[model samples]
Target: AYGFKTATYILDDGALNGLSNDAPIEKLRALEDQTFTSDLDFKAALSNALGDDKAKQYEAILVTAAAKMNSVLILCGILLFVSFYAVSIGPVMWVLFSELFPNRIRGLAISFVGLVNLTFAFLVQLVFPWQLSNLGNSLTFLLYAIFAIIGLLFIVAKVPETKGKSLEELEKLLVKST
Candidate 1:
């Protein structure tokens, strides 16, 4: 979308004009007739077509498109996080908490789990601003992606199969006698 938007903008403004026949913008001008297999392909081709000086002049255009794209991506991320929390994280914890404990200590076990969850939530809220300010958007998001992958690995390795098991069976599988 960004590449297409850029191509359209350049085409509309006649910015492709008056270049020496060998310039990268001239190559880009030729590409205006061809179909790109993917957005990345178009972007790569556009980058290849822009010489350093031309690319510098086009920086404002790319930055404007990037800002809009980042906003859209952030909105989508928030929506996805909310939906995932609603359907997965929020319920799964309670289910796991229920299944992991024996009847004698279920209530206490769940209270502990709930307390941990709340504490982590508060810590996240407290640290998020600092993370964003210190790491910047790209690195902050990269850190989130890394943590999500680590959590996924932990779930795969540590979480027991409880689908057909009773709470007692799950407790037996998940908990060891001390």
Candidate 2:
């Protein structure tokens, strides 16, 4: 299973091959540079090549069967856990972006945020292969996890809770008078 997962990850064809339980860590560490015009294109290619839906179903079965959790299980668990954060963060960021700016400049603020978001997204795509090759998977993901924790902390500490507040109140709470 470990070998299969590693093959799915690192192989050129994105298929399970030449994998074994005792395969060297170097095999997993090896990466290749690839590019796509957009994230959607990359995702579509990955889903087609790697059969991500099949992986998801396999993971679900493994979880439901109460199998002995192995490396794949651990990785999948981490992936799913972070996936929850990914699914939640986008809408939260959008809502926060929309709410934080005053009505007078809201559109401009959103446009700015969108530009920044896309730029960083592009940068991540550009550097991810280099990060995987040079930093290795553990360190690469460690940095992501650390940053995610920091982001969560920042949101908790700095983002004002506007759940019960009216829009006008939120504007006053979030936006400055100036």
lDDT of 1: 0.60
How far residue 102's Cα lies from its native spot in candidate 1, in Å, is: 1.7
Question: For residues 44-156, what per-residue lDDT tens digits would candidate 1 score against the true structure?
Answer: 44566775566556634532332223456566776887898789767887987788778999999899988998998899889987875455445666677788789879988
Give the lowest summed-lDDT range of ten residues in model 1: 1-10
Displacement of the residue 99 alpha carbon in candidate 2, Å: 1.5
> Candidate 2 on 1-178: residue-level lDDT in tens?
2321232222332322333434322422232234332223333444454466643333323222222224676579588867887787776788877777788998999999999989988998999888764564446666766887898899889888768777788887765743
RMSD list, candidates in order: 10.2, 12.5
Tell me the lDDT of model 2 at 99: 72
lDDT of 2 at 134: 55
Candidate 2: lDDT over CA atoms?
Answer: 0.55
- Output the number of the lDDT-best candidate: 1
lDDT of each: 0.60, 0.55
- Superposed Cα deviation of residue 29, candidate 1 (Å): 32
